[model samples]
Target: MPKEIKNHICEEETFTGIYSKYSKSLHDFLYYKFGEYLDPNDKMQEAFIKLWENCKKVPPSSARAFLFKVAGNMMLNDIKHRKVVLRYIQTKPKEYTNESPEFIMEEAQFFDKYQKALSKLPEEQRITFLLSKADKKPHKEIAEMLGVTRRVVDSRVYNASLKLKAELEEFNKFYAKKPSKLL
Candidate 1:
């Protein structure tokens, strides 16, 4: 426990002190968990606001955990909303484009294969790969975020790469047999 935790968070100076103490760590946690799609700052601010609103209910010693719990719940809600939106988007018809049908079809096929391969990966591996490759986060940071050892992150990424490589190779071979102008 830090000295800030001893202060009553309802007081203006104490509240500001608490915010200064935990805001950056909380924001980083949310960002690492949610990735680039969602804004962590908004969620972090909302968590602090909730804390201020419920100041009377939370005790000094437990404020940190309380804040994290509130933020985590908010993030879960956001994830659920995003899933619904994604499903809705997937159901909607695609717009017509000026590109050639062959090019469009090939692109769609490639995307489908890539998605399928990615989906087939184990959840942990997929997450590790995405955090490493898509978010461009380093192994140590990912290790800290995931609460795992750096070696574990490295292993997960290596295994994921191997699986994706094997899957993509098969996809390429299948496409190679087809008579397409794009290839």
Candidate 2:
């Protein structure tokens, strides 16, 4: 009778043996050839995973070469991806802004607090303030639009300003000290 041939790594024992035999060498090969930055350990594990996935298609004798080839190809693909990323970064458009990150953050906080404070104002005061400042309507125009006297419109705007300024006193002090620091 002829000796039984082991033609594939489909069996768990055969696959595990192949992994035990090749994993370390494959990892070392990748590390030596590509350096540690490319993550040889990860590549080795992924190569093993690929081998397991294709175990029935591979023979135990060829498993070492298969793992090395798969891991090397993975490293090459990673290098290619890095090159594409570098190229994209080189070609990316740059937009310059006069404002610093701190300035932008502070501005956003100021707006948030301003909106909250604005919303908390009396309805008449809020409406008058919005019409005068947001709409750029004068006190006379606001009075006409709201059917109120000019004095009432002025009073509402003045009261609203006082409330908003009082609520935002911290921002005012911060803003007062920012110009010199920014320059």
Q: Which ten residues in a row have the lowest lDDT in candidate 2?
A: 174-183
Q: Give the C-alpha miss distance for residue 52 in model 1, angstroms.
A: 0.4
Could you give candidate 1's per-residue lDDT for residues 40-101 as a string of tens digits?
89989999999999987887678889989999899999999989998998896767777899
Error of 1 at 127 (Å): 64
* Predictions in order: lDDT: 0.83, 0.84
Candidate 1: worst-modelled 10 consecutive residues by lDDT:
174-183
Q: By TM-score, who's the top model here?
A: 2
Q: Which pairs of residues have clashing backbones in candidate 1?
A: none
